[model samples]
Structures are given as structure tokens and as C-alpha cells.
Target: MTQTKKNQQPQPAAQPKPGSAFAYAPAPESRSVVDIAPSYGLFIDGEFSDAADGRVFKTVSPSSEEVLSEVAQAGEADVDRAVRAARKAFASWSALPGSERAKYLFRIARIVQERSRELAVLESLDNGKPIRETRDADLPLVAAHFFYYAGWADKLAHAGFGPAPRPLGVAGQVIPWNFPLLMLAWKIAPALATGNTVVLKPAETTPLSALFFADICRQAGLPKGVVNILPGYGDAGAALVAHEGVDKVAFTGSTAVGKQIARTVAGGSKKLTLELGGKGANIVFDDAPIDQAVEGIVNGIFFNQGQVCCAGSRLLVQESVADEVLDALKRRLSTLRVGDPLDKNTDIGAINSAEQLARITALAEAGEAEGAERWSPACELPSAGYWFAPTLFTGVTQAHRVAREEIFGPVLSVLTFRTPAEAVEKANNTPYGLSAGIWTEKGSRILSVANQLRAGVVWANTFNKFDPTSPFGGYKESGFGREGGRHGLEAYLDV
Candidate 1:
């Protein structure tokens, strides 16, 4: 991942000179737009209530370590209460006509769009991602998912699943911290669109947006208990998954936890879908556009501070053009601005939490200890928050820990291949098969390599591009089941 800034062209006069008075000013998004409550409770049965045990936890802004708010910590008793509410609501919710359900979904989608800016700001404050990403990427997709599934509510009969598919009773869903509201939209939109009720537990670190979404549901006039939000840690998620009233279980998190959930539901009647971890490979052939490939490489791994499940953490480049790609990548990394999450100019933000920062630091250290050459730009970070510089490791091999493990941070491991066969072999060597990217000018080569890859989703000439109409999931250790498009509808329907 190390690259030299040599042989680069000089900037034109129109561009701001280094250390000049013409340098850009701070253009920060106003935090005044988001009004945070002093404390919050769980959203159950269309009402807010404290956890049965009265346990509470505080959420902090990762950017400045500021206390955002205190949220109720759900326990087993709370899980039981939420599940019971969902079970009670299932009868009428499922009995509603598809056309009527579509109206509710469409209303939710419209409200999401109307309040998207407020939600996006809250997401950045709670999730520690750049405001640009929360505003442009996460918020837009959240609305699109609701709208997409809203269109499918009345069309399930023509979706080829069956003439009349019945709704699963209740879904117990657990989403990770990486994409809070977007993941909620993914799990809840389909479940509700197919006439199933949901009791969802958002990741502990990021819960504000989901709580706000419960407000959106109320504004949409969605029926009571059709969607329940429980903000808590792992214990609450475990309780929800093991609840007997839940007929379906959906989880999006680490692979180890996904395995645990699978074991818990094994031999039971509960239908399950798990979207887990990935160490996706972004392959660059000699014939690919060097500049375009470098941008894609940055966007794939650096977007969201590399916290994405389907991040292109591994870089597999053809040996013939490796030097060119690495040099260009290095030059590009040097220009990235890493700082304030609210700053529109900031390219990289704080890590989600101190724990995640330590994990990333340890893994990067392991890469250096295991003989991978590490390099990072000379970037100064803010003193108060958890932060890590965008890092790169050159001379990485499939055997190296950095290449094999999911770092889930702003780190990229670079590897090289001599031929197409070697590229495919190296890409498929990973146990996780969530995603892979192919960068090449030749359509034939893109099709050929994509066909041979083991990943469930393959991107050609692009990376990290998502659509609500496109199905997304993983294979093997990355987990099973799709979460988007028409295929996503099947997870909630009983044919």
C-alpha cells in the first residue's frame, strides 16, 4: 500500500497553493439542526417506556467524546415485552390488504425523505461518520429502500414466490453500528412490506437514528407494535433472537456472533438470515484505468472510515502495473483531509469508538510485526477523539494476518498477482465471500473474472455502489441470505 509522490505534475494557478491565504475555510454543517433529548427510552408498542430494570447507558459523539444522550438498556424482560407486543400486532397487520399496507409503507418513505436531513445529522453525531456520507450516502439510500419496498407491498403475488405468500409472524432483527438507519431500513422495510411485524435492536454504540426512526414511524401513522425499537447491548440482542414469539431472526454483524445465532436457532422453526463480515478483494488488472482504479480503491476502503462489512480491504493488483497503481494511490492518500465529522471538507472522520480504534491499531501493528511494509500520510489528528490515519500495507500476502483478518478500519492491505488465474486464486482464498470488485476496461475480462469469483456480489469497474433494487448478501463465512431487491422479499414471506 506504500506509494511515492514522485513524478507528479504541478498544480495549476487556479488551484490553491500549499500554505497560501487562498486555502479553504472551515465549512461545517450546523449541529443546531438536530435536537437531542437529555434521555431516551425504548420504543415499544408505539410508545416509549423505560427498560424493565431501569438500566441506562450514555451514547457519546465519537468526534469529540461528547455525551450525546442517555438511552435505556434493554434486558431479557424488555425483550419479552417487545416480542409480546409484536405478536399481538401481527394478526391485524398481516390481515390488512396488500394495497393498504402499501399505503403505510409509502407514507413512511415520504416522511423519511422529509426528515432525512435531521436524521442524517443525528446519524453523524452518534455514528462518528463524516456528515457528507451520512447526508449523501446513508440518508438517500434509507429513503430509497423504503420507497422500493413500498412499491413491492402489493406486488408480492407477481414476484413469483407463490400466488399468495403468508407473512412470518414476528421478526427479531439485530443490526450493527456501521449503518444504523440504513440497516434498519433494510431489515424493517422488507419485513413490514411483506406484512410481518418487527422487533429490532440497533447496535449499542449507535442508537439515536433508530430511535428517531421510531418517531418517523409514529409520524407515518404506522400501526402500534408494527415496528419496535430496543436500544441496548449484546444481551438484549441475544434475548430477542432467542425469544419464542419471534418467528424469524435476522442479524447483521460479525461472523462469530452470526454463528452463535445460527446455533441458537438450529433445528427450530425460526427462519433465519445473517449478514456478516467480509474481507472483500478489489482486483486491478494491467489494462484498467490507473486513475479511475485509484479513486475506486480509496472509495471502497476509506469510505465510512473502512467500517463497512463489504469493504475492499484487500487490494490485488496485476504485478505489471502494481508500481503505477501504488504510486498513484499514495499521491491520492496524501491529499485526503482527516478531521471533523461535521466538516464538509473532511474526508476521514473519527473511529466509531475507542475499543474499535484499539482493535484497528493492534491489527495494524500485527501487519508490521508480520513483515508487511506499513505506510501512512503525515496527517495530524484531533486530540480529543478516537482517530486513526488512513493506512496502507505493501508486500502483503494471503498468509499475513492483516490480509486474512477483517480489520474493519481505515486500513488497506496491498497484494499483487502475475496473471488472471493467480488473481482469481488469490481473491477466492479468503474464507469470507461477501463482495469483490473488478477494475478493467475489457467487459469480457470483467465478466470472466466475476463469474469465477466466490463472492455473492461482484462489482465491475466500480466499488461500494449500492442500489435498493439490487440484491445484496454474502456466501460462506460471510453469512447467508440476501437483503435487497426482490430476493430480499423472500426472507419474510412464507410460501
Candidate 2:
């Protein structure tokens, strides 16, 4: 393992016990003017109610480490109730005229727009994305996703689906923390539009926005029980996927969990879609524009603190242009402002939680110990929050742990290739096949390499671009199924 300067502590269990004082948690703060209700419960049958077991968990803010709210901790019984409600509603909701369904979706989209700032602020607070990206990129795209799929609700007959396409009974969706409300929109809009009801579980670390979404459903006058939001830990998610009443399971998270989900759902009648991890390769050819490529590389890995599943963590530069690209990359990275998510000038935000920060710190240390040269801008990280400066490791070989694993932080690993074939070989070296980027002036080369790549999404000289009209997902261990465009509707449709 490469030893990072930040991770040289003795193992906790190995350390001698020290006389310590009483433990105290951070004090909770007054609620933000954000319209959150006290004592949130599971949304079932279009109503919010306590969990069957009456268990609850505290959701905290990554920025200030403040307790934001207490949310229902769902278990098997709650999962069963949610599934039943969705199953019952699916019949009527799906049976409604397609135009009516489209109208419901359109109403939801308008409501989202009306409360865009609130949703974006809440998302940034809960998930720790920069306020700028959450407001400008994530939330808007989330609303747009609904609008795009809204138009398709009445047009499924014209979609590639065969004649008389039908809705799956009930869909259980599990999304990750990196892109909370956006992921919910990705899952729910398409599912509901195709006429399926949804039992959506947002990541435990970032459930606030989804619960807010449940409120939006009420405001939009969506039929009772058509959409439900459950906030809980992993066991709750497991129960949702294994429930026999659910007609489909759609998930976005790590590959290991995705594999387990696949195993759990195997041989079942329920359909499954997984958008798992990615160690995306951002390649820069010698003839590519150096300044633009540097910007692309920064946006690729540094956006969302590199917590994104589609984050381009690997940089494959042609050997001839490697030095120039690295130089420009360093200069560009130096200028990135990292701090409070609420600050309009902040460039990067906090790591989603203490646990995630620990994982990223451990992996970064391993890279240094394994002989990869690590670098970071001289920017000061905030002391009270979970922060990791955007980082890079040069002289990185494919064998290094940092090169192979998904650090899921703002860390980049740069590797050199002699030719385009070598670039492709190194780019596809990891198990993940989510997304990849190519930077070059040569049009034919872009198409040639893109065709040969195994990833589901390919960006030519662009990074982290999203639109409602484009299908997005991953290949191989990155998980299965698509999330956007017309193709996304397939997951909810019965053959």
C-alpha cells in the first residue's frame, strides 16, 4: 500500500488505551427556513406514517455535522406495506389515460421548478454538493428529466416498446448519495411515466430531498399511493429489493452491492436495472488542445468531490503530450475554490460523511505507500468539515491500488500510453465500464475508439454532461440498464 502523509496513524485496535473524558456529540442547530416537517415518516399509500417497528434515524449535514432531521427507519414490515400500496395503486395509476399520466408528470415538473431553490439548497446541505452544481446542474436536470419523460408518458406506443406496452406493477428504486434527488428523478419519472408506481429509497446519508419530493407529489395532486419515499439504512434497501410484490428493482451505487442485488433478484419475475461504480478513463491525445483537455480532466474527476459514479478518475495521456497536459492540469487545479457548499464562490464541497472521508483518505494513503507520487493544490481544507482537497497521483502504474480502485474522492491518477490502442487497453483495465472521455481533433479517431470502448456513455471532449433526452448508464461491473432518454422507459414497461 502507498502511505499517504494524511494516514500514518496506528490502527485503533492496536493502540494502547488512553484515559479519556466523557463523549459528547455536536449540538443540533435550529432548523433552516427550509420547510421540513418535524418527525418524518415513511410515505406509503400516498400518506406519511411511522414505521411498523417505530424505529428512526438521524440524518446529518456533512458541512456542519449538524443533525438535520429524524427520519423513519424502515424495515421488512414497512417495505411490505409500501409494496402493497404501490401494487394497489399501480392498477389505477397505470390504467389511467396516457395523457392524464403526462399531465401528472407535467404538474410535478412545474412544482419542482417553483421550489427549485429550496430543493437545491436542501440537496446541497444533505448531500454536500456545491450549491452551484446542485442548483444549476443537478436540480434543473432533475426537473428536465421529468419534463422529458412527461412528454413520453403519452407516447410509449411510438417508443421502441412493442404494441400495447404495459406498466410493471410496482417498482422499488434505490439511489445513492452522490446525486440524491437527481437520481430519484431518474428512477421515478421514467417508472411513473411508463405507468408504474414507485417505492423509492434514497441513500440514508442523503434522504432529505426525496422526502421533500414526496411533499411535492402531494402539492401536485398526484394520485394517492403512486409514489412513496422511504429513508433507511442498507437493510431497509435489501428488504425493498427482495420483496416479491415489487415488479422491478432499479439501483445506482457501488459494484459490490450491485452484484449482491443481482444475486438477490436472480430467477425472479421482477425486472432489474443497476447503475454501479466507474473508474472512467479520460484520455488526452498528443494533438488535443492542452488547455481544454486540462479543463475536461478537472471537471471529469473533481466535480462532486469525485464522489460521482461516472467521475473520470483515470487520466490516460499519450506519452508525447503527457508533460504538457500534466502542467496545465496542475495550474488549473490550483485555481479551484474548495469550501462551504453554501458559498457561491466555492468550487468543491464536503465529503458526504465521515465514513466516506475515511475511505478516501485510506485509499489515498495506499497510493503513496505503493510508490505513486501524490500531489494537491496548496489550498487550505476546512477544519470542522469532512474535506479532501482535489488530488492527483502521477507515475501511477495500473498495478497501484489508487489506479485500480474507486477512491470516490477528488483524486486523479495519471498514466501514460504510447498509442491509441494502448490508451484503450489501459482505459478499460478496470472492472467498471460506466463512462469514458476522449479528447482529440481527429473525428474518425473519436468514433473508432468510441465504438471499441465497452462503456455505456462516451464523451467526446466533454465531461459530466447530462440531458433528459440522452440515455445514460454503464456496461460490465458498472451495472446494467439505462437511465435517460427514450431507452430509460424500458425498465418500467411490461413486455
Candidate 3:
């Protein structure tokens, strides 16, 4: 009969019994690899120096509430000192050949790559994001940012602004705690590449990585005073923003603070850019690939435990398949492991602080009080540190506070639309215009929806993707000024 035998698929691997026998063994990364000192001094004029007033604050690991180190608290006087140092360094730093600057940047990028493992471990320990994310996303992006801007250092003349572009005098930068090193990269890389010296402020809770970066500056033999780092609370940041010597200012934090900086620098000669908050919308159509969409939904909201400014906190599903997607997403959420940030298998980690956790709880409570359906996966959180179970409110509407506010935690507000036009309208109803996501099988629809979106960044068929080469910022109240790519260079140059 000449019939061919049917091809057989490989058999599944055997699974162990459901008990300690099948449990994943603890594979925590060694904490000793990172040398967190008992206390750290401010990085001023390229050297570690105490605050002028001898004031210092403690920084602790959010995961364990363990004290990491004491950091110098910069006051108004320290901010002035840092600004003057930057201004003085600006002359020589600006006069250096673009090629010379490129060398320094390239050296810094290589050092970052070499010490990436140590930095990754430190980031996880301090930031409460999983080691997997720090290793896979943050470190690579940080190194790439320096490398990307390094190429731009010598090539600015040909960047199409003009044949000759001049540098801004001194850039004052303040980065948030969410992605400390990456935000620092976004601020420092282009500023340095464009021939400006910088005075940077690490958030109060997270200052160790930026302090380590000062050591990198020394390793590169970067000129003294070219890069100054101040680790302190909001008063220090406010003072830096108010400093008269700084020619340019860049900040990434909450919208409230961004608005305050805008008001503080209003009518001044200083150039400013603020990358602020978001309530991104992740929309799924009936024809979307359901499995991939579910994964994107989880990643968009739950990544970094939803600490990201551009996290997709709002989910819009087409009514035709809304129930199907919700069912699938809830099932997927149950599979996620949430616990120790150092665990290689952990999908979610601790909330950044008790204050942030309380905010999340209050907003979640509001969702339930306003008659929305509140649901969370049954997961155990460590009692020692701040934690919030990943949650979703399925009955949210545009009128609800949960749908309007930026929770800045791992909480999703689900809304449904019957058509693409309605989805677009509902998504744009919010005051935020930071980022959005759309998933559909139709190519033309992707283009159409994206064109209608007011957000600065949009993703189709994917979520939470970033590149050093792409420009990132927001529209409306989400704040302004692009932070990456060729556009970012313009913010630092006087063309």
C-alpha cells in the first residue's frame, strides 16, 4: 500500500511529584560581590566629600528593609557648590576635541560592560527589581546608552542641526529611583556627548549606583569636576533646579515634582526637560493573537512591579473577545512567581517603599468603593518588606478614579470597547500621553490607531520594549522634551 508511517513528536520530560521534591532550590546571588560601604560621601569635583553641613540620610534595601548605607544629604549650599564646580569644569570640558570626548565615553561604556554583572546584582539588591530584569534589561540598556551617545560625540557636526553645534554650559540632572542607572544614562550620555559637564542627583532612596558611577568617572580619568553627583532628598533636588549656574536641567520623576520644576525654572534662561508619569493603555482587538496578547498584558503592567512610568496600567479589550482575554490573563497571572528579587525565577518583586505601597492600596480601595470589581491573584507576600499583590479592577470606566490616576504600581484597570474608534476615544480620554500599546492582526489598523494616538511612544503587538536609539518622552501633562536618539542631542546643543 506504500503508506508512510506517521511521524512522532518528542515525548514530554518527566515532572517530579508536587512537594519539596519538585520545588525550586534557592539560588540567590551572592551579596558579598557588591561592596556597599557603611556610609558614602558626595561626589563633588570628582572626589568623595562630606556634605558641607555634615547631614546624612540612610538608604535601605526595599526588599528586606535592610540598611544599605548612609548617603550625604545635599542642602542648598551643596547644590551651589556642585553647580559652580560643573560651571568651572565646563570650560575645559567644552573646549576638548569631540574625538577626545568620544574616547572618554567609549572607555566609560566598556567599563560599564565589564562591571555589568556586579552592577546588575547591586541594582537588584537595592532597587527591588528581580535580578533577571536588571541583568536582561537595565544593565544592557545602560551600557548601550553610553555606547550610543559615544558615537554621537564626534559626529555631532554631521547630525544635521548645523555644521557647527555649540554645547550647553552645564547640565543639572535629577533621575528617579525606578531605573536609577538607566535614567542616569539617559541624562548623562547625551549631556557628555554634547560637550556639557553635569551635576546629577540620585533619588533619596537609591544613591549607591550613581556613587559607583563616580568611581567609573575616575577610572576613565575624566577631568575633575566634569561630573558631580549629589545624593539627597527633594530639598536638594529643588535647590539644584533653582541653581543659577546650571545652564540646562533634566529631571525624571513624578508629575507633581516635574510641574514644580517647571514653575521653578519658569522665565529663567535655563533649558529644561522633564520625563514624568504615565497611565499607558494596552488595547487588544478581537482578532489579536490571544496568547501573545496575554503575555504582553502581563509584561506591560507587571514589569518592574509596575514601577515604570510608561507601564500599561490600563487594559482595553474589544467586547467580542474581552471575556476570553480576561480569563486567559488571570490564568497566566496565577503562574507568575512573586518573592525575592534575587531569585532567578521570580517574576515580580517588592514594591519600592511603604509610601508607594500605601498609595497603591488606597487607589485599589477606591476602585472597589467606586463599584469596580477588584480581583488579585492568590499569592503570598513577604511580611518583612513592602509588597502589593498584583491586582486588577475589571469593571473600570473612564469616569472612575482608578482609570484616571497614575497608581505607579502593579495594578490594572480593565475597560472594554466595542470598536476601534471607541477604543481610541477611551484611551485618549485620560490626561496622560506618555505611552500606549495596540495588538491586532491587521497591519493597516495598526497604522491607523497609532496615528490617532497622542502618546509619545506606542507599541504594536508588543509591550514595554525600549531602545537606546529611540527617542522617549511624553505629551500634555506627562511632561516634555525627548530623552534619546538624535532629538535628545538637540536638547544639549545650542544650534
After superposing candidate 3, which stretches have Cα over 4 Å from the reference?
1-23
Task: Give per-residue CA lDDT, model 3, range 385-495, as digits (tens).
Answer: 878889999878888889999999999999999989999999899888999999999999999999999999999999999898899999998999999989999999998
Q: Lowest-lDDT window of 10 residues in candidate 2?
A: 1-10
- List where candidate 2 sits over 4 angstroms from the true fold: 1-33
- lDDT string for model 2 (1-495, tens) is 111112112223323347632322222221243655546889988898999999999988898787777899999999999998888888899899889999999999999999888888788888888888888999899899999999999999999899789998899999999999899999999998999999999999998899999989999999988998989999999999999898899999989999999999998898999999999999999989889889899999999999989999999999998988998899888788787777666789999999999999999999999999999988888778799999999999999999899999999999999989999999988898999999999999999999988899999989999999999998889988898998998888987
Looking at model 2, residue 279 earns an lDDT score of 93
Q: Estimate each model's TM-score.
A: 0.96, 0.93, 0.96
lDDT for 323 (candidate 3) = 93
CA deviation > 4 Å runs, candidate 1: 1-22
Error of 1 at 260 (Å): 0.5
- Tell me the lDDT of candidate 1: 0.93
Give the clashing residue pairs of candidate 2, or none. 1-370, 2-366, 2-368, 2-369, 2-370, 3-368, 3-369, 4-365
lDDT of each: 0.93, 0.89, 0.91
Best by lDDT: 1
Candidate 1's residue-wise lDDT over 1-495, tens digit each?
122212213234345778743544566777767778878999999999999999999999899898888999999999999999999999999999888998998898889888878888889889889989999999999989988998999999998899999999999999999999999999999999999999999999999999999988899999999999999999999999999999999999999999999999999999999999999999999999999999999999999999999999999999999999999999999989898888777899989999999999999999999999999998889999889999999999889999999999999999999999999999999889999999999999999999999999999989999999999999999999999999999999998
The TM-score, computed over Cα atoms with residue i paired to residue i, of candidate 2 is: 0.93
| Evaluation by lDDT, superior candidate among 2 and 3 | 3
